[model samples]
Target: MKKQIALLLSLLLAPLVSAAPAPEREKAQPSAHHVAIGLPDWARGSTIYEINVRQFSATGKFSAVTADLPRLKALGVDVLWLMPIHPIGEVNRKGPLGSYYAAQDYLGVNPEFGTEQDLRDLVNAAHAQGQRVILDWVPNHVSPDNPLTKTHPEFFWRDEQGNLTPPHGTDWTDVVQFDFRVPALLDYQADVLLHWVKNFGIDGFRCDVAWGLPTPFWNEVVRRVRAVKPDALFLAEAELPQQQVAAFNLSYGFDLHHAMNQIAQCKRSASALDEAYAKIHAHFPRGAALMVFTSSHDENSWAGTEFERMGAGYAPFAVLTFLLDGVPMIYNGQEAGLDRRLEFFQRDPIVWPAETHPTTRLYQVMTKLRREHPALHTGSPMRRLDTTDNATFYALERTAADGRRVVGLFNLTAKDAKADLFDPALAGEWRDAFTGETVKLDALVPLDLKAWRYRVLVK
Candidate 1:
């Protein structure tokens, strides 16, 4: 009886052993591709905008977003990130509807939004407009009723009784966490990701909750995707620095976002911006790209809208993010200054019009200037200038390889503040970017900064 039991175990294990060795052995061996192939340095100077297509317009379709591309491109955006477009799960649906993150099918598009042709056309149009499109990818979990759940139940996490469990520490009852222990599951996911890049011609992926998955899995995923498309960019929705050298082109900058949030909440002075920049500059490597945003989908949905979160500091924060040594992201409707946080699991639509919005102009000017100025293009240090009154102000000058310099100053307090051109390197006859008024470096630049206004002095 013991011999028969051992024979049964061998039969069960033999297939897996034979299957795992080939892939594992291939990955274990180093290849020419093992060398770190960094993303285009030009991407360092670009800005990213998050697009929640379902909630972005009244129509909530790709056609609606395509209409706004000219405006967004005019706003100086380099990348457009469309939220998950796959079908939502109906099983154990939360709230009045299902969540976009709860993907029901990896390869299928959500017909509720539009047909696959619509997505392909969107990509083609964006490429023609010289803007890149990145799709938000949810790899950690899937909807409970996903075909994989029914067909390959062994591919997901299970208890001793083989009951599947949801992701830990949340009321996310609609989805089930995948079991990375299953090698077959990893292959399927990689293949799906590669399929979109090859078939739909997506420029990149913005992986959601990237840290939840095993690091080695990402290494494999990135490797497989790059094998098909060498120029593909990967943006991890995580703050960890380790994700940079291997799996992703950039990672989210939560610390910078926190600092700006603090300023907006009145918890910290505008000088806090310098502290945040310092932390990122010192910790992250020089070539690494940072995703700087005033607010993202998670922040808008859970915390508040950008208008609510940033308040007085909204415009200044947007400008800072664009000028800072990182890739800036504009959440959908941010240009319209949309105040209400849309429902995460329901169809909450955005209203748009032809009139110019405050944020729209602000973003347009900031992005255009950033793209035009080489000093703001790279992840380099800002030469700090001495300030006598550090209470509500911080000043720095950034120079590019071509000897072009731009002096940036900020005012955090509600009252007016003053700063003299202390750096001879930056001292010269300069013009204010906002007003286009010429001023001399010999006298103090008369600054009547409202709550969160900033000035960029160009020579």
Candidate 2:
């Protein structure tokens, strides 16, 4: 009778035994341009924003974010990226409020924020406003307490001591890295992502540290996920231009952000951006899109805010992002000019201004202009214009084939500048995009612009 009872117990726990490596996917196609997945039609010429639910409101729930949807819509954001909504692991945590990226269960929702229904409601609310929702996916690692850590131990990297290891040379203590070479883990990861899209009506995925995983895995994941939701958008946190062929619609444009930082510090000239463009032209494939931003959740929490880096030049850099060849993103609280570095692992509500703030007004105008102008859309050709002071001032002309044209001139210096614009395209009648004032541009005329001011003219 004792032997029988012991056998029964072992049988019950057998499913939780350390997992073995699964079989590799066979007959995999080339990762490049398999079926041509591109950005959704509504996403073009639209702005995306990141939302930190834990920090977005006092209640720190999906309901709070749903209530604030109208505000985001009014601010002219088109896509909403919600940070990881999965339960955080408790075994080895970061702080009182643990990092959102540490997911203990792929299939479970974090009850501290809200239930699965709340997430569904938020996605529905966003869709009703013609906005898209993408969940932040942690594909590289999972909380050490994740069920897979015990049940599928072979899927993770174990140190010499036989304990799970974190990403090498990093202080990411809360989570353990996944072994990508374990072919079975790739299948499991892909299925976990697909479950979200199928069940929650999620429009897409903003993959975190996508570079940590093999590009082939992404190619497979993207191909498989889109097999369910054909129009699903995939965005990579990585900046490698090669990732374009890995089946991502957009990749972070770290080059532009770094160049902008240098320009703000007067360490690089306007021509410096040309180098970034050249790199893109040489490496990035035809359909690749860059996600441009002066601030993101990572940048805001780790590096200084845009106001800190750009100082007086913040607005101009913000405008430059909108006018570039990529999509522009607004971080949470950026519109209100939230000047402080928001805490990453804690409940820090955004200090929203009671009245309509200046930065908010600027975004409102830029978003509207982006929607109204065809020249500002992605793939629209840009022509570099000559300016008197290459270091303190910069100018470019964006034009569409349909005769829609926009000329953006920026004075990035701390003092006022009168830059002489020299281009035949500027010798026509134009209207200021901001003030709606009519100004005829002559190649010889120098416009007096305030410190860190930008003039966008349209004809």
Candidate 3:
């Protein structure tokens, strides 16, 4: 009887011992895997989309945009960044339509876009769809006839001649710069930002020309904004080292973006992207997130559309943006592969060029992979692995907790390239992220890349 009882105990203990080596055990231990690091409660694993309200739809109203919340949510977008919706100043406007940055009134919504009630409804609709809305805030300058100028002329930045000056070097006669030296100016601006958060439940702000403002002012503004919305995400439009000190959650990855564009245009080789990627890790402080993208409002309008800038390299470059560190973004009409550069200060709309261009399929696949893989999500640092094919192809590895590793290989040229891959740390059979096939690491991976094609493998 004693032997039988001992045998039963041994049988029960054996299963628990075997199950103890499960995924949960590895998660508890300290890890070398860059993925599985937690983002702040507010912005972890979140992706943003820039909304060009003026050209998103025919009427260019918030109500129309509100109706598309389900569509955007389905696309895996977490935050919606709306360009300035405030009233555009009529005097000294840029063109027939006027710049959105030129604000006539700070308090009122632009009637052209929608009414105050319409905007409130839009916010409500977005919230219902599990999406947060952030407004594009122009802190450095305001319309020449802004209410602040009329009420307090002393608030504006003045030159040696005591005349209101434009920000930086510009032909922007329609807007005047603000002097951050005045504490009252900061207070007023902070109060305005808080009003939106407090009244309408705005999730956050995408500060325009953020590098132009004083660091101290931004620190104060961030504090003030948080006092109302504790978990607000501040997206700085400019890429400045001091922005991290000001508690900004993210800044533009301009250096990396510039390099990627150069490679796409055939001005630089694939090695250029490696250098750019290295610089970002060197310059940006730890926990400082950079916003990565192929197209944003500034690049789309001033420079060129993605098709023009990236050309044949668009798909592979996009794959990099999605799988690499930092949050990826899709500008309005980007997923639909909008070809033309919409006029900045005009009513030019995207004609849905996806049917002909067929780039949406690439974006969808990348976005899906990003959503499914922890190795591709935020907090994972991309490490460039040694590759035999240097000129036309490169390889990178991203490891997550639980020993899951993803290897990404890119062939930037228009011909077949072979890659010799070796990593002792990588284990198990790897599967292709796009094609969903097993990849063998024992031999050279022959890739027949058509210009911008890329392959991402996961274990």
Please state every model's RMSD to the true fold in angstroms.
Answer: 5.1, 4.9, 19.8
Which has the greatest lDDT?
A: 2
**66-146: candidate 2 lDDT, tens digit per residue:** 999999999999889999999999877988879999999999999988999999999999999989999999998899899
Model 3, global lDDT: 0.76
Model 1, residue 270: C-alpha shift (Å): 2.7
Where's the lowest-lDDT run of ten residues in candidate 3?
20-29
Q: What would the per-residue lDDT of candidate 1 be over residues 1-459, giving only the tens digit for each residue? A: 999999999888443332221112111122222333356665766788889988988888888788777877787888889999999999988876588899999999998788999899888888998888999999989998999987877677754445666775557889987777788888998999989998999989999878777667888889899888877889887765556657888888888899888877778876777787676555554466678888888899998987788777777788778667677889888888888898887789977757878778778777777778888775655676667666577666777888887787787665666755354565468888788899677544444565577888887
Q: Score candidate 2 by TM-score against the native.
A: 0.91
Task: Point out where model 1 deviates above 4 Å.
Answer: 1-38, 419-421, 443-448
Question: lDDT at 275 for candidate 1?
Answer: 86
Q: Against the true structure, what is each candidate's TM-score?
A: 0.89, 0.91, 0.87
| Candidate 3 regions with alpha-carbon error over 4 angstroms | 1-39, 353-357, 443-448
| lDDT tens digits, residue span 194-293, model 3 | 9899888889889987877766788888888887777788888777655565458788888879988888877777888778666655555666677889
TM-score of 3: 0.87
Compare the candidates by TM-score and give the number of the best one: 2
lDDT: worst 10-residue window of model 1: 21-30
Local distance difference test, each candidate: 0.77, 0.83, 0.76
